[model samples]
Target: MANDGLSAGAAARRLGVAVTTLRTWHQRYGLGPSRHEPGHHRRYTVDDMVRLQVMQRLTAQGVAPAEAAAWARRSPGTDPAPSDAPPSGPVAPADSPDPALRAAAAAARESILSLVESGAMIADVGLGDARAGGGQTIALGPRVDPAARGLARAAMRLDGPSMRYILESAVTHRGVISAWTNVMMPVLIGIGERYEATDRFIEVEHLLSRAITEALSIVPRPPRELTPRVLLAATDEEQHTLPLEALAAALAENGVPSRLLGARVPSRALMDAVDRTGPAVVVLWSQLPGSGDVTQLQHLLSRPHPPVVVAAAGPGWPLADLPPTVTPLNGLAEAVRVISTVKA
Candidate 1:
């Protein structure tokens, strides 16, 4: 049956809260169900579901339910709005995209490009002169081209010292992982290409890449909790283990016990692991285009007994032909949110 309308049990399940909590909201807050049937069964609609979701999000962010409810009530027909503005304030000013800032960005890009094309190390030129007030020394690196790197660096609102610190930290960290890969990788790649195109920052790209890889390594995975058992692995030809590692870490953080099988596991091995562990969920990492043996995967997914939830992460996921039961994980945050919702 279509679940467009929610019963009390279903609503509680969807909200990730106890049934009693939902009842309390109805009684105390007057956020009652939309309708009551002849037998006194409460029914909630899509609007009610959305309101609950907004309230849940706000409450999770440390807002009191009463405040969230008031905000929701005021907003009415909209999502829950924050009671207060962010301390950092609004994102853009009336005169944003300030002319001076844009010009500086352009000049920085040009400078880096010129130096890189001429075989000069970006770190040698130093970002110190790029500063507005000539207050501090700025150092660019060999891995990125200067001008383009400078523009990107400026955009990030990072100082030379901070950039240097990030680069040094990356050297110790390791490789690209899940949400980081999705959110940061694309931006980083763009920065690198811009530097290359402008001939501004050869060192900047290299330094940034190294730093990101290092940072990934340094971020410790959380200790596994004794919750529902889950197994994680990557498909054959999907040698990137970072996403799986990240998912495992997130799962652990959420108190979902998980074991990582690492990269490039064969189909039989994956099946065997599932058989041996009898896991509730089997997370598979594959950046779509590069994944091999899809047919084998499809066949294995058809098996009965030991119901499994398959989660696919990375670039190739959208392109891959997945079974009806499989879930495409867009990024690290979404993955964690989904897992938590499932657990709840």
Candidate 2:
């Protein structure tokens, strides 16, 4: 170590986080460097690095940033001249009163490394196969966000609280669209691929889906004054509803109210819903090809008071067979943009 202290770049490099993240920690949470050399920029002393390591570890374990900062600020060993290197790994808050935090701390380092090495920024890192880690890890590809890594690790461990924390943080901080597109989708896809290849991790998939649904449902809905002119449902025999859930949440984020009929809506029932609600927009989701019958879309179009927009979503739909009036929604953002702008 230099006789002075480490610059911000050096500190971020050592900690495996983006320089902007460190700047956020410094500006918002007050976990900034303390050592100011003669005429150079303030640098992170060994003690400052220790606190940040604690901060990094806790946040990676799905702890909220403000709470993690509070813990980091009070972390022991802030006073004395530190050793040449920061602690080799994350330092747990042993004296914490919260048992859940303590439990998470106990396994945070190993769990973080399972999906992301040394808790580094996720880029071009080939996290090994599930079999390599005793079926407790899922690999996300290059340039993925750290929240995705945390969620993947939590999903593998079946840690509901941590998974919820990571997911909620993503949704709250990044908004529903960014959260769904960046953080949640990647992990979900990785797990789906994992299940397909090995015929395993069904439990993992179920739990993660439940967590995502729970997280998305908490997005505050638009006021009742604005009637929900948008309707969402899955086609007959289509049990997959997570994407629809995400769309609902994203719409809510845009202050657009929507009625979500959930999974496996029969053609008759969906028609009945459309008739009763007279929704301006109706989105039918189909996750598998067999479930996406073009006839269903035809049924909606034939209604006496047909919707302004009848949309088909998910990979199951046969684009060529879709009714001429039906709008094909390729992704969540596009679905939101199309549905939220419809005239009643």
Candidate 3:
């Protein structure tokens, strides 16, 4: 009733929804008002409460949370009418969209999605084919993309040898992770053309992913006395373990001890590992969309125990509607940052 702010818990109570549900709406739909904090607790304004009410109404009517949030933003009487209802300005000549560009973009997106779904590896489409015509040789390496290079520079400061090893492994292995990285090279080149248009980098990419996964599996765990322990693994349906394995290596490099549980770890085994290790974090890697049983996993995660931080990576986590407690691991560098921050 008042415009005064309410904490997330209070607001959730007023809306009669679970706190996880509220946080999900906030993250997915951007429905909540700006958060202001005094000390460390989050507080939401009256506007956010109003939006939540509207969201509830729309959701009850079968509208998705994202669509409901959009509706709430544009509802009548919420804002004044625009000054120009219809512009009478001269219109520029309209040109037809390029079918070739659209096709290329679609093809690239399809390739990436298919690779993730099928667990297809990446292969090097040798630049020799393109270079035979006397064109400049396209360079391929770990820091191949400028953005990835920038990230590498800022994060780990990977040297030429390390970068080369990563790139070579990815190109040769054809693992899904490796393919994603290699494909990123051409995808970056065709950014203006849309993500779907880039050529497939299947074989070498998959090889790289597999190699990374294998390397991480062999990397020794850190000493137990160094810091609080953590367990890293993938969900049962998640065959992609490169991301989690990378995180495990990062933890070892950072002096935080962790056990790499490898890929396709069942929930029972994961819980058993947790019970045995008493870890501070449980990192789960899931790259493929709709591949893991998130609902059941969440129920497992909610149980009382050593307060565990669940870090999720890849495309699957975002679609799983995970609780805010489960943080998204974006990249190798980000994984390091999160673990370091938590340890500190």
List clash counts for every candidate, in order: 36, 0, 33
Give lDDT tens digits, candidate 1, residues 183-219. Answer: 3344366754666566665555555544444444444
lDDT, candidate 2, 133-243, per-residue tens: 333568798778778877887687666766887787678868999999988999999999999989999999999999999999889999989999999999999999999
Per-residue CA lDDT of model 3 for 1-344, tens digit only, reads: 22335666656654445567666666665555455557755555444555565555444323445555555444432321122122122221222263322232233334334543563322211112211212212233544544233223211211222333333333334433343444333423332232234443333344434434454454455666675567788888887665666666656666677778887888888877777777777777777676656753574576677435677766676554777667777876677777766742
What is the model-wide C-alpha lDDT for candidate 1? 0.51
TM-score, one value per model: 0.42, 0.67, 0.42
Error of 3 at 70 (Å): 60
Q: lDDT of each prediction vs. the true structure?
A: 0.51, 0.77, 0.50
Would you list the clashing residue pairs of candidate 2?
A: none
Best of the two (1, 3) by lDDT: 1
Error of 3 at 323 (Å): 1.9
Q: Give the TM-score of candidate 1.
A: 0.42
Say which candidate scores most in lDDT: 2
RMSD of 2: 12.5
Candidate 3, which segments miss by more than 4 Å at Cα?
A: 1-202, 210-221, 224-228
Residue-level lDDT for 23 in candidate 2? 77
Whole-model lDDT, model 3? 0.50
